[model samples]
Target: MERERESVSAMFGAVPEAAGMARDVLREALEKWEVRKGADDAALVLTELVTNAIRHGTTISVRVVRERDDALRLEVADGSRDLPRPRTASTEDEDGRGMLIVTALALDWGVRPFLGGKTVFALLKVG
Candidate 1:
């Protein structure tokens, strides 16, 4: 397999503003990589990951890597060691739908554990 990759990584404090910054960074990175087809979905999924991190951790770092010609992998690492689980949201519920959206958009996703925290990742196939 031929490998062509570009990556963007940044650290953000746990705050509401981090989500928007992440989206902007992802948008610019995708544009630079010429992978605009799934930019909206990518931004949405990135927002959810960052938001979740801000809620549970003190500091977060997000990395988006263009894995190949058509695959992009997004990883959000946080100070918390907890892994996220997808849950079925109630009809009247306003939350718990983030991971569902991720599952629907990503080709595959998973979590990786490190010494002091964990990284949640989603892979999107965008040509």
Candidate 2:
């Protein structure tokens, strides 16, 4: 038997507002797929990923996928080949905490090289 799956994707401009926009879209998509358990965590992760992409790339694309067991996967693709480095941030730092939050929340997360840039993905075991 095969597991059922649902996916939603979109592209957003490389602007400050993109993160909020991505969160809205992700929330809608997750709700449609009945993924409520990890929705808040997913939103936080999405905000971090989308914000990082906007800071480094010109165009960003977001993707969310849900499996039959309710595990959720979120990805943010940017138009830059620069790889993501997860690092610890100091309390005084104004930024550089995105990946830290992602690392703490995601079941697993990594990057994959794509055509123009790379895709950073986080998986959450919602089930």
TM-score of each: 0.94, 0.92
Candidate 1 is scored at a TM of 0.94
lDDT of each: 0.89, 0.88
lDDT of 1 by residue, 1-127 (tens): 6557889999999999999999888988987887878888888889989998999947989999999978889999998988888899999998999888888898888999999999999998887
Model 2 lDDT tens row, 1-127: 5357888889999999999999988889876776678789999999999999999858899998886565889999998998877887788989888998999999999999988899999998764
lDDT of 2 at 24: 89
Model 2 quality (TM-score): 0.92
In candidate 1, stretches whose alpha carbon ends up further than 4 angstroms from where it belongs are 1-3
Query: Candidate 2: misplaced stretches above 4 Å?
Result: 1-3
Candidate with best lDDT: 1
Model 1 — which ten-residue stretch has the worst lDDT? 1-10
Supply the global lDDT for candidate 2: 0.88
